[model samples]
Target: MLPLAPSFDTVGWLTRDLATLDRVVRVMLPEGSRAASGAAIPEVLLSVLDPAVVQAFRSAVALLVERGGFDKPDDVELPDVKATYAAFRTVQAAEAWRVHGPWLTEHPGSVSGAVADRFRVAAAVTPDEERRARNVLAEARGALRALLAERTLLLPSAASPAPQASAGGAEVDRVRGATLTLTCLAAVAGAPSLSAPLARVGGAPLGVALVSAPGSDRSLLELAGALVDETAVP
Candidate 1:
């Protein structure tokens, strides 16, 4: 889950991540279209959400942010988070279609051909749309950072697990696990660490961990469990 506080710097961290995402979109989008200036095309793409792809992306982002501590028990206005997540997926799907659309149409019988055909249609109809999605994704990233800036200090929740005693330090051990996960998330997002110590538990560095897992994989679940466990530990 994304951390909401304790790592207020996550806003800056997200900004850097978005910049990297922009680079990725540039590389994936049509050669010339990527270089074209203005956010017009990208905006249009964001407006049209691909049900499956955008939903998947939103789910993944929500899970990731929630793990990092950005989630609030009370509803938080996170338009940027939702928008960015959707745009990222849309751009990725569009780019995939652009690259493989022709191949799919050529070999309709094959799975690749089928996928390619779908992409081909998507690209053909929404050439500018793909670029627009990328731009929206960038903007969403920026918005998330701004949102995070206002928050500070993340508290543990009932969902978290019990902390374990370790020689290094109880808090340190708990934080170590969270830190490891957060660092991995940062690497994936192309963002820096927005993690900080929240408290001291049995001489351990118990802090709110802000990891970023993109999908609901076993590894991510395990890490989340660890985070919650540490928090719940007495």
Candidate 2:
């Protein structure tokens, strides 16, 4: 689906348990792969954290420190995230236009209203904008990869727990903004993030995301499994 944007696009699974996912990673990666570990994990994506989400992360981090014997995570300097997000969006839209515009134009009637509008926006992204966005992606990957060379990153999977099924439009938008804020860090950096389902609010499940440099998918999965095992979360 991401022809022009293949550099950043990847495929993975979502599940109820991290251990099962870890086993799948074990089978996929080459033998003798080792998970990376170190102090000084740079944490990000706090601007969108809901109160409940914040609490869940704090609890999860405490568990990790107590059980895994890791130091508490501290804030690390990062580049302009808003700019990074804009760059990712530009590149993604440019590529989406290239990959999906032809068929969508031929069968315009088959597309949903919102999706068609998105395609229209993609079809309008300028080449200059795409070039700038690609530069931002490269610089971001370089910076984040250096930060993650020996340490992992921690973030919330979403801004908050699952919204009530009856949530209104404004509420849904709020949730989406928060989710994008946290998720784009990994996506734009072309890293793999393992979702750890260690949080609950109002009896609904949520996740704390653990992200690492590219090529560390196996390590991320294994670390997530250990977090679950130590805390007996899922």
Candidate 3:
């Protein structure tokens, strides 16, 4: 459901088994994989990317190549990745403001303390800043479209393995930028990205994500199914 933000919301599945996910997604999207990419895999990286996440991603990419007949992942260059993420941050937060500002004003106590504070930042988002963010998005998306036209980039869904329930708030905030950096690539580009349950680190699930050209949602999902069929989960 991409109601508040349709473009950024690619079809995502968080299931125990990606093979079962294939059956359900194909039924829902009803799209074939003929047009799905057959190009060399390109896995973009941010400087802030954690080594562990990179290790897991490399293992998954290797599996995709050895078993699924996919190409090896290459390093693709992105401009000002940190800036790209910040721009997306502005765009999403501004959109969130429009969705919740009025409701929150009338019902102040409906939201939690941390979220309520974030809403304040959203409230302060200026129109000029949003326009600038849109410009950044436009430029990046054009380059990204050309770069990913025939390739898929692999990445980790988060900077680390799954977070513990009892982790500190300060800790979460500290690593928040790295966690969102890779995911924001697809978000800002308005492209399709699929997060497959491929990697496990520290006994917890570590998702391996794929980013492709815009409007490639079904193709991306097809690739996800292919990955599931090829790679052994355990």
How high is each candidate's TM-score? 0.33, 0.87, 0.85
Alpha-carbon runs more than 4 Å astray in model 3: 30-46, 229-231
The 10-residue segment with the lowest total lDDT in model 3? 32-41
* lDDT value, residue 234 of candidate 2: 43
What tens digits encode model 3's per-residue C-alpha lDDT throughout 26-85? 677745333335443334453456676677767777887776547655566776786788
lDDT of each: 0.37, 0.72, 0.71
Off by over 4 Å in 2: 1-4, 31-35, 39-44
**Residue 46 Cα positional deviation in candidate 1, in Å, after optimal superposition:** 21
lDDT of candidate 1 over 109-171, digit per residue (tens): 666443444455456646677677667755655643443333321222111233455435546
CA error at residue 1 for candidate 1, angstroms = 26
Alpha carbon lDDT of residue 150, candidate 2?
65
TM-score of 3: 0.85
Residue 117 miss distance in model 2 (angstroms): 2.8
Which is superior by lDDT, 1 or 3?
Answer: 3
Q: Which candidate order results from sorting by TM-score in descending order?
A: 2, 3, 1
Number of clashing residue pairs in every model? 34, 0, 0
Residues 1-234, model 2: lDDT tens digits = 446466557777866566666677678775433445653433455645667767777787787877774577767767678788788778878888888788878886877755666678799999988898889888987887777776687776787887889988679877876677678778877778887677776677777778777777876666666555634774
